[model samples]
Target: MTAPVRTRSSEDLIRAEEPVLAHNYHPLPVVVSRAEGVWVEDVEGRRYLDLLAGYSALNFGHRHPALIAAAHEQLDRLTLTSRAFHNDRLAEFAERLAGLVGLDMVLPMNTGAEAVESGIKVARKWAYDVKGVPADRATIVVAAENFHGRTTTIVGFSTDETARAGFGPFAPGFRIVPYNDLAALEAAVDETTAAVLIEPIQGEAGVIIPDEGYLTGVRELTRRTGCLFVADEIQSGLGRTGRTLAVDHESVVPDVLLLGKALGGGIVPVSAVVANRDVLGVLGPGEHGSTFGGNPLAAAVGTAVVDLLETGEFQRRAAELGAVLRDGLTGLVGKGVVGFRSRGLWAGVDVDPALGTGREVSARLMGEGVLVKDTHGSTIRLAPPLTITEDELLNALATLGRVLERSV
Candidate 1:
């Protein structure tokens, strides 16, 4: 008979990972054994309110019933049938997903980085084939301080030294421009430009929400310059920002949309590059493909996520609760928070440096039964699950307040 697995405490489990696990991440010290909705229970049976929500990947919360039901039903039937063969669930997923984003076509992939890479390839192809750019001369304009992905090519353009250092030599034909600066963007784009890619809200750069009209200005500039505008809505889309996409706040639509994070309903790694036919049609069948893209399981779960978004309940909750979040942060401005930037349920709070570094503050919050992550030096980001009740949010805020008070 197989030996029964030994149950371990949170500290024991954490210590066990140090030897075998890669040190690529410095996650908070919490061994979550079970989770439901907005709460997670550690191995020791202590519960904590999940405030970071998997960097917005768990926007619908842990083990969402509808999403889980879809996953279970699909698992019983089929899972992966590589792009070599058609999956029965792919058609509806593509149709509904494209419809949800007001796009004409979908090229499914797994992970946000894949979607960004795929979008880049499609844009370059369009530039050479349609825009008449010379071969190997296609250039993409991207904003500085961007966090598209960790892939070599993506990091090559990143302004963050931590993500870019020791990862080169990077591919060429890319231009870096200051974010939210239309004048600088206009100067950067020219005939060789394939696309201007940017995140609607810079999530990893501490939820940096651009000034009003920034997105619209990007759309207009791209249209005039004849370059495609690719919005990386991977972290800001699918009801996290109180809308289908963060670009919706300005009623602007880009030529290509890169989506991920919550698209899989927190069950799978699902991502896609969505675009109109003319832009996406540039790619031939033999040019690009992913083996597991649009598999049956991912399609089913993605379709269920789209169905939930169609009802707009999550978006409404994000918007209404966003006001509550904003007000709470406002109250904390002078208390412990020096400043903050917020959109919907997403926020980057800058706490007083005298209190402690962001990581230190996060550790303190963990002791108070709350979980959040730090972005930069003194900035901690908050992106709680949309399913969280008003009382839960208030309680989390109160917990933060108590932690800050004790620190002082």
Candidate 2:
């Protein structure tokens, strides 16, 4: 039997989705049909340099050969065991991931938000069982304008009105303090504080990097206050920021590390909470578990990801290419760019309002065969895949410069 051929354009697909799919996201009009490395082809066969890189989920680029091969091999074997019975792949995955991050244990999950939620639970449990904090008085200190995840509990303490509006009545036991302010953080922590949760580099808040020694201060303060330090590296870790972990830049180690995004190698959804036994050990049998967590398929892909990072090739690429990116963006400072904050190849560029809003600039760039995403009013993030070649990256930057000039 022959299958019926379909002839729907990108506009048709977009229109078709509007009525049936949820309107939670306002994505760009481009409908990608295929991708490889740092380039994606839309439904109509137009190619664009992917500067956004799936918001760091594609840190290794789309359909990396090694990652795809691992996935294919795993699919041929076992796919899922539902955490009911032990799988052969889980142990090595856990061990390699833990060793790569210098942690003692790994609690695998499917998404970044789930890893965050699990970290919260682990911190609270450790507070009661180990730290001797009172049952109901455990509090976690978080930074203002931080982007951890979008769960109901995670959003409960968010300072952003858009994220929290009408999503309450909310959970308590979270204290918000100004980010990068050691004094404010110290003032907020007390006997009831169970942990201080923070993003080593605030990704959603426009890649906001803290002042020097801020993470170090966080470690010292958490240690002195008898509380755990949890670094939400879901967006900043696993070679996204030219290091195995962003905290490595400061030589600081948090008690708990939340990892996601690149963990699944851009092929599947894989996230994990890495911590020492003292912190994650607080969980007992039946306390918390995920049916698909630590499944064999995720394990295989995650192990492959760890293998890639172990060679330090991606980390080196991000570091070396980061210099080029910094220079390119710096040259645009007096052009249409106002300023930017960058570490490694990841950057948040502030477009001059006189030119246009970030969204407008992004749309124009898309027309110029480049792809980027806007965050705030006049800010766009750039995090190209580490696998992008020097020529490709420079070409994207040149396109960005041209787009800005045209906008003006």
In candidate 2 the C-alpha lDDT for residue 15 amounts to 98
**How much is 109 displaced in model 1, in angstroms?**
0.2
TM-score of each: 0.98, 0.98
Alpha-carbon lDDT, every model: 0.94, 0.93
lDDT for 335 (candidate 1): 87
| Candidate 2: residue 329 Cα off by (Å) | 0.4
Weakest 10 consecutive residues, lDDT, candidate 2? 1-10
lDDT of each residue in 67-112, candidate 1, tens digit only: 9999999999999989998889999999999999898999999999
Off by over 4 Å in 2: 1-7
**Per-candidate total of colliding backbone pairs:** 0, 0
- By lDDT, who's the top model here? 1
